[model samples]
Structure formats: structure tokens, C-alpha cells
Target: MASLLLPIAAAFLLLRVILSATVIDDLRNLRPPPDFNSTIARNCHHNPSLRYCGNSRPLDEIFKFTIVASHLCNESRNPNCVESFDKIDLRGRPKIAPLYLSFDFFWKFCPLTIRSIDFSNNSLRGEFPTSVLACAQAEAIDFSHNELSGDFPVERLASMVNLTVLNLSYNHFSECKLSESLVFRRFNSSNFVHSGLIPNKQSFAVKAVFLMIGLPVMVILTVGFIAMMCFRRRNLSLETPQLRHHFTTSMLKAATSGFSSENLEEKSDGVDIYRGILRDGTHVRIEIYWSNISTEGMRKFIEECEVLVQLRHKNLVRVFGWCDDQELRAIVTKWTDRESLEMWLIERAPPLKHRLKVLAGVMEGMCYLHKSWPQVGYDLGTSSIILSENLEPLISRFEFDGRNSSAKSKFVYKHKFGVLLLEMITDRGKMGDVEAGKAGFIEHIRTSFTANWQNLLDERIMIASTTMEQARQAIEIGLACIDHSANEQLNMDWIRHILLRIYRASCHVNGSPTHGRFDGDRDKRHKHGP
Candidate 1:
């Protein structure tokens, strides 16, 4: 009994020590109240110091905590040392909402440790206080269920690195800009439903389409109003008009159910690939943490995003937009459930006609890439080409580094395309198949093809009717492109023309459908003499 009593006494003393620090916690009535002595915050081996003090400063006797909960923070040791104050809930108290003076007090005394602040359901009115940014290290801020109005400075919000938790829903903002590269992972279209925010993609496209069609009609009806509108639009600095809405990491999590294993398709170091469905019922694949935002990296990536969004072609995969969040970075691209071209090659041994179409499409896309972004290189392997529902091959990867960066050569990309064609034409035993030699994929192709050129056509295609000769022609051109030693090598332009001819001939001979069926008369000029 004596031993047990001594242990109980020590426990009681520890409890008293914790409860005494609850002075500020009472005024706000924190929900699921924080544990000041939360063992998790003490992950660091070093002893917590008193340099910044552990007690939150009292504003006054009545409303004691106006400043910040910076006491438990020890940045040098545990980076998450201050998450105990993760959420400062001064909610449900209508009187607290209108106190701009209290907000200023928060700014002056805040030790930059707060991550979340909840002031929802306070019946707060008027503009969102600029002082809310006072929690300089804020991660989550809730201003929902209020009557706030005016512009939502989303561009300004982009500066916050870990600002993942946010809800400005049920507000009356006149304008919300979605043009910034920061895609709130969740899109949260419902959050801004009644808030009068225009999504970037529809906002720009709709306006352009409306202006093009409506302007002529409006001009004929009333020229003066048209002139006024045109002048105003030119002067208005309204979000610069983006054609696609950037998605945030939060929106992605919601779409992918917090990137659950079921939705995760691939997991690599610091990178993850997921399958997601957009609000519009579009299927997409998200590659998360694509790469770290190194020095001047965000700017370069933004440029890449701008460039990628503008590329429109049948052979290239569609990129919706990119996320530049500090915690997680990702790129969103249109996706389908179809197998990649390599899979089609290995498993189904796609027909000669399908193979020809793949080659033609890949070459066409590469040509467009060279013309559109000559400085960039097409990035891919055998598995990089995915066959769409219609059997059209789409090049799913490309990379654009800085101008001085090595990935900036049209010729190099052309050579790469040639190697791809060679790979497609042969059955290399595996997707990334290699010969018994130490020679790399490219080197093996160069030497092997030169040695036994005749048996090179994949056995799958060798038996393919009527298109076999055409397949041979494609192989010849591919060899010439990769043969750098040749004085007169095949350029992509001539290659494109020849492949187009072969595709037409193969279609005519096999009665092969165009696009899997072509237009009227079937380009009879490309047909061979019977």
C-alpha cells in the first residue's frame, strides 16, 4: 500500500503540472483539447529549453490568449515540436470575430509556431482579415461559414508552403483567381460554389468562345457596349486567364482517397503514381513528388507547365496541369486503362496495321515536338508509349530542362525516336530486353541489326499479311536514322512522309481501317500497283 501510494502521488503531481498550463486553453474551448505534454512532440533527444518560454502570453485577464501558442516549440530539435498548437480554435464565439484589435495582438506576440487557426461558425462578417496571415508559419486556416466578401488573393496564398488545410467555403468573394500554379490538391469546387470564383480553364475558354461568337452579334446590336467591354477587358488584370486549373495536393488526396494503396499504381523513391478521377468524370494519372523544387526550380517547372499545357497533338498525352506544393509536388495527365504499346507488343503481338499506326503516330508526335519545342527531348522507354482506346499510340513522356541543359537537341530526340521504332519492329524477348553482351539497349540495336538484318523483323510481324514489306521499309529507315556514321542519314521529315506512305499502303492492302479507318478514297496515290 505504501509503494502504490508513492507512485500515485508522483502521478498526481505530474497531472497538476499539466493542468496548471490550461489557462489559455479554457477561453477558446479547444475541441479534442491538445495535450501540452504530448509525448510525440518530445521526439528529440535534447532537453527542451526555456529560451522562448513555455507559457503562452496572456492578452489580459478576461480573454487571456490573444497572441500565439508558441511555448512548446523547439525548432532546433523536433521540426514538428509545435504541432500541439496546430489548431487554435476561437470558434462559436460571435464576439471574437469582429475583434481586429485582437488579430493585431496575435501578430505582435506570435512566435511563428502556429500551424492552424479555426475561427469558423463565429458568424464573422466583412472582408477576410489580412491579419490572418499573422501566423507566419501557418499551415491551416479556416474562415468558412462566414459572410466574408471581396477578392480572394490566391496568388498571395501561394507563398505559404504547407498551407494544405483551408476552407473559405460559404463566402461571398466577388473574385477568386485559380491561375496560380498552386493547385489545392482537392480542387474543392464545392467550397467555392456559391463564392463566385471562376475556375481557370472554363473561365478563359468560355470567355474566349463567348467573345468570338458573341462579340460579332453584340457589335451588330450595340457597338458602343462592345467597345466599352473590350477596353475594360484590356485594362483588367484578371488572373491573366489560364486555360487549365492547377490542382493542389489536398484535392489530389481527396480524389485518390489520401493516395490509398488501392489507388496507388507505382511507388518509387520520392515519387508515386496514382489513378484519380476528376470532378468532370475524367480519368487521370497523378505522378506525385515528381521532383524536388531545387534552386530556381519552381520557376523552371512553371515554365515547363506552361509549355506542356499548350502542346495539343494526337500522339502526345494530355497534361492537365502541375502542383508546386512544398510538401508534395505532382503532375496530372489524362489517363486511360489501356495497356502500353510495349505490353501490346509482348502480350497481344498487335497486328502489322496497328504497329504501323503506332510508328506513324509516334513519329508525327516527335515531329510536332521538334517544331513546337526544339530545345526539349522526348523522354521514354519501350513502356513509355501507351495505346489509346482507338489503338493510337501516345507518347506519354517528355523532358524540357534549361536551354544550356543537355536535353535540348532536336537531332538527339530524332535519334531517340528512331531507336524506339527499331525496338517496336523487333521482339527483343523482353520489354527492356538486352543481348548477352554488356552493350546498352541503343548499342545492342546498332550492332545486332547490322549483323542479321533479314531475321530482324519481329516474328509477330513476319507472319503479318500484306504489311510485311511495308514493315521492312520502316525498319530500313530506322536503321539509317540510328546510323550516325552515315554521311546522309534519314531526317524525321522524310521519315514522316515515308511512314505515312507505308501506313496508307498497308491500310489499302489489308483493307486496314483508317485511324484503325481513313477518309474517302483512301489516298489512292499511296497504294502500290497491283
Candidate 2:
């Protein structure tokens, strides 16, 4: 008995030693480092057995998702159970086929694990589940071609800060609550298609794609474009009249009346405005558009200046050149001593007939910019537009945004400005009862007036059109040019044609009277006349 016990003890000791030497350290080393943000919660399914998943050793070898799906659907015996995918390596796979994984079971396994969800054409029924809102980082949600009902749960979705696109097409959400903010409301009705929600053209997916694909390409293109522009501008600057003058600091000092306050036209955006004479004694206005801007700030301003330099039109105000020598920065433009139309309307009681003539000239200038030279609006409103010695209006101060290279036209900004013009003309030179330069004065004009043509027409101009149908046509066309929809607004080309007809008819209708008046008032009002 003693001999048998000794041999058994020896054998047990040997086995224990071998197991410790071979397996224990290997198992300790093989343990996975923890991932704190893993999709553990998403793997909860309608399965009780998967509750033990937390205890599984060699955990990487087990599929929590497959286990939950089988447990929920009671498909442990099915050959094509989600378990089939358990052994398949899914890393770096570019495509996910929806049919292979039953979405019902997929939801059961992990509802919020996905970053993108395209459940379109699923024939899924019922209201859009609020549970999906749990997916905080979801970027796109496509529920199109389904049977979803009820108003869009905007309140719930407001929490999804990163959600950029929400497609509910071919559904029944007719009276859904929506965000009225421009960022939210910019989407069109077409995104709600076939009684479903239509995606906005500026949808997150499109914007992201633009950012990811189009934006980088755009940046590359922009860099190349700006480089070429800088090269061309350098060449053009050498040939410009302002550069040819070879203006010296002393020359600028002498021209600016020693930078006197009396010569200052107006203070704007920290810029000092001075009426200057060039070295050749050519009169020109100089605006020392200065800022204590950081290096980045200066770059942005210079970029804007570069964009402005490309534009050329008679109706548009031209920047001759800029000076950035040393700590000083300045901009120069053609100076008109007559000032803006706004100043004239305020100070001088230019008669209604003369005012109409000024307005006609304004329209002519706008027509040339919008149609003839074929740049949209130069953003020329009352301030940017200058009047000549005879009160002829000229549009000025053309600006462009280099950052927005894809902006095809300035139609939207121009149409709003046109509406303001309508209000200005109709208000009979009386800007408002409010004090001049008050905030919201311009905005009040925009909002207070009705968009209807009759309501917007100036009573003064209305009297001018009486018994002159052609003048009436001119007023009608001017109103049309300011229509809110850019497509509906008349381009300068169409406006020019209309003005030609109006001119011809004016000659036929009031030609005799105008001629008679011209002959009578020739010496008093006009130096030269029929």
C-alpha cells in the first residue's frame, strides 16, 4: 500500500507541474486588453442564454451578436442562422447586404451599433420608432419606400446633433413639425416625395461627400485657381493706371490734404476715408481700409480683395489697386464728388421728374451689370451707387467671396435689393419717419411694404405714368425685376429690351410734350437740349 501511494503522488505532482508550465502563463498572456467603448449594450437581444456572454473565455472567438440573434428568433437549429456569419471574417468588407441579416433580428441583436442605416424599401410598417433616436452619432437615416406614418418626431431628433440627412420618402407625414431656422428650413418640399420626406439638397450626406470628396478637390482646385489668379493679378497690376502713376508716400500725403478731417467723407469699419489727388493730380478717393488684424485676419482680407480685383464693368465700382506697404493698408477707387444717390435723396429736393430720370439711369446701370457684362448684381444699393454732376447713377463697389468659388450667381442677394429699390422709389424720397442711420431702417422698408406691384409703386411715379402706358410698363417691369424668386426676376438683358420698348413708346406718347417742355425749359434745367 505505501509503495502504491508513493507512485500515485509522484504521478500527480508531475501532471500539475506540466500543466502550470505549459498552459497557465499562455492563458494569462492571451487575455484581451479592454475596450471601454465597445458595443456591448447593442448586443442585447431577446435571448436569455446570451446573458452568460460576459463570462466567455477566449472572448474574441465568440460572437455576442450571433448568439443574441439566435436566442431572439429561436433559430438555433436553422442552418442559415446569423451564426453562419460568426465564422466569416467581416473586417474591411466594403458592402453590407441587408437581405442576409434579417433586420428584425439585426435590431434585436444590436440596434444602435451602426453609424449609417439604409432601411429603404423594407416595407416596414408603423410609426418611426423613437427608439432609433438612441443612436446619437447617426449621420444618415433612410426610411424611404416604407409604410411609416405620423408627424416627424422633431423634438426627439433635435438631440441627434450629428444627423445630417433624414429621408422618409413615400410615407404619410403631411403635417410634421419642422425647425424654422434657416439651417433647418433650407430644405425644399421636394425632399418629402410621394407623401414622404424629401432630403434637402444641402443634406449631410451630400455635404459630407462634398467635405470628404468634393471639398478636398475643391480646396485643391481653389489653391490652383488662386495661384493662377495671383499670377495674372500681378501682371494686371503692373499695367493698371494706379500703378503707372508710381504714387509715392509724399504724393499720397499731398493728395489727401494731409489726411485732414475736412477731406474725410465718412468713417467706416475703422477705415479712414479721404479724397485724394494722384501724383498726376488725377482726383481719386482713397480709403485706408486698415485693421489691427492678426496674420490670419490679413490673409482673409487680402483674399477678399483678390476676388474683388477680378471684376470689371462700367456699372460696378472698380478698385484701382491696394497698398499694403509696411504697417499701412489702403484701397483706392474712382472718386465722385457728387456722392451716393442716398445722400442726394436726403439733402437735395431733386424734383420727381428728375428723380425718375435718375431711377431710369440706375436701372440702366443694373441692366448692364446683370445682362450685358453678365455678372449678377454688384450689391450696388443706395450706398454703393454714385451720382454724376448731372445726377446720372453709376453702380460701384463690386465684391466677390473667394471661399465660395462655386457660387454661380448673385441673383438671390440682388432680388432682395431690388425689392428694397421698389420700396425706396415708392416711398416718395421720404425714407421713413425714423431718424436717419437708425438700425432696422432699411429692414423696416423691406418688411413693412407688401410685395404686390400696385402697393409697391411710388405715388409720385404713378402720377408720371398717367396716360402714358409705356411708363406704366416700365414700372411693372421694375417690380418684376425684384421678385423674390430669382428665376422669376428679369435679367438685365430682358430689362434692357423692355426699357427700349418703353423708350420708343415714351417718345411716341409724351414725345411732343417732352420736346415742347425741353424747348421751353432748355436754358434753365439743361445746358444742352432739343
Clashes of each: 14, 9
Tens-digit lDDT track of model 1 for 251-314:
8988898889999999998889999988888889998875666858887877777778777988
TM-score of each: 0.50, 0.41
Q: Write the per-residue lDDT of candidate 2 for residues 311-334, one digit (tens) a residue.
A: 565445666556655556776777
Clashing pairs in 2: 191-197, 191-198, 192-196, 192-197, 192-198, 210-215, 317-396, 317-397, 426-458
Cα lDDT of candidate 2 equals: 0.51
Model 2 misplaced stretches (Cα beyond 4 Å)? 1-251, 296-312, 346-377, 402-410, 428-459, 462-471, 512-530
Worst 10 residues of 2 by lDDT: 85-94
Q: List lDDT for all candidates, in order.
A: 0.63, 0.51
RMSD of 1: 27.3
